[model samples]
Target: MKQLFISIFFLMNFVCCFAQEINDKEIDSLYKEDQFYAGVTYNLLGKMPKDVSQSGFSLGFHLGFIKDMPINKNRNIAIGLGLGYSANSFNQNLLINKDNTGSTIYSVLKDSNTFTKNKFSSHLIELPIEFRWRTSTATDYNFWRIYMGFKLGYVFAHTTKYRGDLGKLRFSNIEDFNNFQYGITLSAGYNTWNIFLYYALNPIFSGDASLDGNKIDMNAVKIGLMFYIL
Candidate 1:
């Protein structure tokens, strides 16, 4: 599965690169004219996808506004700011942790028939700053752009629920899930309306590792649609 993700990253990059080569000059002219825009996007996040290969899918919606300032016109370097909301979760068997002191930690891992079915959901506020380049313009109103950016997110709301043979436990205020995830987002699509995909490089959990090595993988890939709302 990891290899599959790597392949996708490379493929998207290849397509973007080739397209840029063909229309780099044309795109450069228009990008300077459009420095700020606002849009709405609907995203589907697939979390712990390594485990939930068949049934793991989470949905998210984003209403964001971005402003761009040029650093270089030839390379298409710019700074951007954006805010969005996202939520995702999954269910599977796990082994929880319990401490002799302090609050007991639970590990609903990949193994253990103790059967730890859990759900993790979050409401996020994000600020992303990126550098983007554009290529391939069918016209001044429509073109393709490729951007690589970094996003920092704060968890405004987070919850983790566990259910096992022993019944149920809910941890709604703990900081088990890593509140910070830093990664590069590669986006490619048209200017009027585009399809954006993202991959997070960091794990979402920030505690001790359990038997399955905290098998609750935080790496996620999301697909979203972007368009002008204003």
Candidate 2:
């Protein structure tokens, strides 16, 4: 019994030591080459209707990978492709005051100012081709980059939730959401990683008489961590 106990203890200790050594070696050998990383982003759509105060901004979280090429000892560049999913929401509370026949009472909310919320969400596949300049080694990597790119996507899902004394109302457009959409991205960052800001000029919808301009714009600002895979 004593001999067995001693053997088991030695075996466990040996395994632990081996694992620790392997972990350190793995980290030391790792470099920013042909590696993949993912992160989150926030989108703020400005230039909204004057009467309507923007309540919801689009928020997105994504992951991507890059293939790097070394140009010289102090310079390198990389290209990457990634797929991500994102959701956007907008909410606002309005103060509606109406005077009917000398009697003045604030209604629930209506007309230009309404107590309601509109939300949009979609899943997207994005491809990013970025150029980077860096001074990093296998042990410690550091650099910065300027990336200009575009994303082409379609809305997979959409809905508008209107709640008031009327109870609840929901609208969904499976056809409209799939419409072709494109956006441009211009960003500057420090290190191989980048913080990007992007805007979409096209509107997802056309304004109709009933809804003025139900047009939805794809505008957002995103910040994420990036790595090079060569």
Candidate 3:
């Protein structure tokens, strides 16, 4: 009985040691690429109304984490899935206000002198999926990367503010603004600094808002620099 107990203890310890050795080997051999990223963008409105244009500075900020899954043996080619947050503000001449009956109104500002500031901002939660290709190695931290992907976002908070000669008008969570936004993204560069572009596939607003019976079809185009950390 004593001999059997000693044998069992020795076997358990050996098994544990083997398992630990395997774990260490797996970890040491594993190479993971860019799992975190942050970016800044200059926001622009595309396909604008006839007289609608941008003013001031339109900027966007984005940050996220991606799960890098290597598909090839070299690990340079991978697919990334991530969740991120984006805050974008578009400063433009489009004036959004409310009527006396509490209905929303949209119009273009012809005279810049009439208004102090008129702009709209939206904050969203975004999901990003990318096909990643890079010149990266296990020991090399500096490499060139070109990543293209699709991003789907949900606008959780939004606001439109107008401060002008007619006092200040501010609206929260405008119904006309589309809550669901999706776009295509591209990023390419070497090392940490990368050029990024996001072109929205859909309009930012619903078709209910119009100018002189013409549908106000507008989308967003953002181009900026992105930084990634492993």
Point to the candidate with the largest lDDT. 3
Task: Per model, state how many residue pairs clash.
Answer: 11, 9, 0
Candidate 3 — number of clashing residue pairs? 0
lDDT winner, 2 or 3: 3
C-alpha RMSD between model 2 and the true structure: 13.2
For model 1, residues 1-230, the per-residue Cα lDDT tens digits are 35334444554554455445545455345344233332223333345434333223344444455676666645355566666655544334332344666553554355445544556566677777767676532245455677678867777777766676667766674656677766666566765556666677776666443334444554545665444221
Rank the models by TM-score, top first. Answer: 3, 1, 2
| Residues 36-92, model 2: lDDT tens digits | 434445545554433544454434554454455445543344443444444444343
Question: Which 10-residue span in candidate 3 carries the lowest summed lDDT?
Answer: 19-28
The 10-residue segment of model 2 with minimum total lDDT is: 103-112
TM-score list, all predictions:
0.60, 0.58, 0.87
Q: What TM-score does prediction 2 earn? A: 0.58
* Candidate with the greatest TM-score versus the true structure: 3
Residue 50, model 1, lDDT: 41
Q: For all the candidates, what are their Cα RMSDs to the real structure?
A: 9.1, 13.2, 15.1
**lDDT (C-alpha) at residue 74 in model 1:** 51
Clashing pairs in 2: 33-229, 33-230, 34-229, 34-230, 35-229, 38-63, 43-220, 143-191, 144-191
Candidate with the larger TM-score of 1 and 3: 3
Candidate 2, after superposition: displacement of residue 58 in Å? Answer: 4.3
